[model samples]
Target: MKKCLKKLELKIYHVVKGEKIDGVHAGVYGDVTGIWGDVTGIEGDVTGIRGDVTGIWGNVSGIRGGVTGIRGGVSGIRGDVTGIYGDVSGIEGDVTGICGDVTGIEGYVSGIYGDVSGIEGDVTGICGDVSGIEGYVSGIRGDVNDAKLTDNERLSGIDVSQLIKN
Candidate 1:
């Protein structure tokens, strides 16, 4: 009888093989054809895979993952920009963060809590805060908040008719 019809042939077994499958199929004499394995998550667009990626990513061509909010232009950047709150424009390199706000014409920054604006170059911070108008500033530690005097910084002793008010 054709060797008992190859011993009543019927073969079906699946432990896990996926594209989409959903739960609850215990052992012994198993046969799950396709589609039913409680797929909790997975949706559009993913490529490669290496390390460290958290949330909210868009138009990312190159980032090793450490950028938190508001990125525009970004022609070139190298590394080490941490815990940024907001606002960074045309950076060349070198920024170490605690808080935010850096508008650059040139670069080289260190441990700024907030605020450094440059039209030319060279800003060094310790407690770090300066508003506008600079031709030269060296080693500032706290409060230079909203300083605007640029007719060569009003020649070091300001009072040209109280700067034309009234």
Candidate 2:
């Protein structure tokens, strides 16, 4: 009888909205109101984040740090950010930041308040003020309130899969 069946183990835990989850979480989340720690190896939509986060994959919102495969609004990023792909908007930063190629942007992109580098993308119906920039942006339509370009070049290329850890 034992040879006819195989053993299996399953663990399931649901994370509610506005609840606090600390340490590393490797699973799917929905409408996450707050995350007090880093989320690694995530393969689903992570939304409504209200804290500092890092190393997140898939469509993410309201977070920062080494992120990849992200498709959402990013604000207040404060480090070397690499390998970001997909549609994004409202990227506001305060320190040295780096970004990869973006597909398209629509709406407002206000206040890149620090040294930003390597942002390559196409913009449509966008308006805002950028304090400093050292990257490339093409196909811009709309208005830029204020901008300061330093070098305007591609810094380096990075792979999206390498930014995550198992």
Candidate 3:
């Protein structure tokens, strides 16, 4: 019988295979890849994740959009979500969209795009793609490649003295 209905549709898509829509407005469209749960007040266009999006009005685009093993608390994403892959843990809020090539982020992302890796926390509105950042950055506008930070002295962007550790 069609291989027992394709092995019960791959065991019911490995026991529900993501996408827990909540408070339906537009009622979900395409590419919620392997969704787990908690898309709240969605209008349309969710690309991919394991779970937990609080509020999306519309336009959640995708390319390599797989937010793997996500923690929680993404407040907003407008559109053009891209290439966010692997071990995104303890995200706080406010990603306005156009995400690109983000990898293993810790928390508090704002906007803009480029290759980011192993970020820690308080990335106050990332503008032009930081790489290997550690902690306590005030305003990053562009290019802090392979950085490690502490000692809150209000570090600005454009390679602020290679993340000043005085």
Candidate 4:
């Protein structure tokens, strides 16, 4: 039997939704993420990454890094969160993540939505949609979405205000 070292690395834990990765099944990696180790990397790097509680939406992204180990078609390093969900916007009447690295802030929604507008790179720990490195969706209380940022309001390290604020 193979030692499915699911939680072998402390970097990624049960961050994925509905997944229970254990070192007793030895799984593969790929784009068909459905649970904790599925597409064990970014949230929406190419398609789907769901966690609900923002536990593990998008972490290390891009098909680049060192030693991407896992089961399934999910290959890529979620090692240091090279890239998380970036920033984006949603059109009127839109309630889903259109683009950028989207993660559920708080709620039991179906999927993150974004339409018409899209972005590139991670938006896990900074402000503005064009920020550099791990882009933050919302890390602070004063964080105003870039899409919704007003000339009078203050922005922490999060953009998408137009989608968040508006």
Query: Which one is best on TM-score?
Result: 2
- Residue 65 lDDT in candidate 4: 31
Q: After superposition, how far is residue 157 of candidate 4 from its true place, in Å?
A: 33
lDDT of 1 by residue, 1-166 (tens): 3554455777755565556446654343433343443533445445454444334333333233333433233323333333443333344434333233333223333333333433233344434444453344444444444546667657877744444433
The lDDT for every candidate, in the order shown, is 0.41, 0.45, 0.44, 0.37
Worst 10 residues of 3 by lDDT: 9-18
- The candidate scoring highest on lDDT is 2
- lDDT tens digits, residues 31-125, model 4? 45433434443233353434333344544345333222222322232334323233322223433233333443332222233332334444454
Model 1's lDDT to the true fold? 0.41
RMSD of each: 13.3, 17.4, 16.7, 19.5
lDDT by residue (49-86, candidate 3, tens digit) is: 44454444556444343344333334334333445554
- TM-score-based ranking: 2, 1, 3, 4
Compose the digit string of candidate 2's lDDT tens values, residues 59-82. Answer: 534434433333344554444443
Task: Compute the lDDT of residue 121 as modeled in candidate 2.
Answer: 56
Pitting candidate 1 against candidate 3, the one with the higher lDDT is 3
Q: By summed lDDT, which 10 consecutive residues of candidate 1 come out lowest? A: 97-106
Ranking by lDDT: 2, 3, 1, 4
Q: What ranges in model 3 sit over 4 Å off?
A: 1-100, 103-159, 164-166
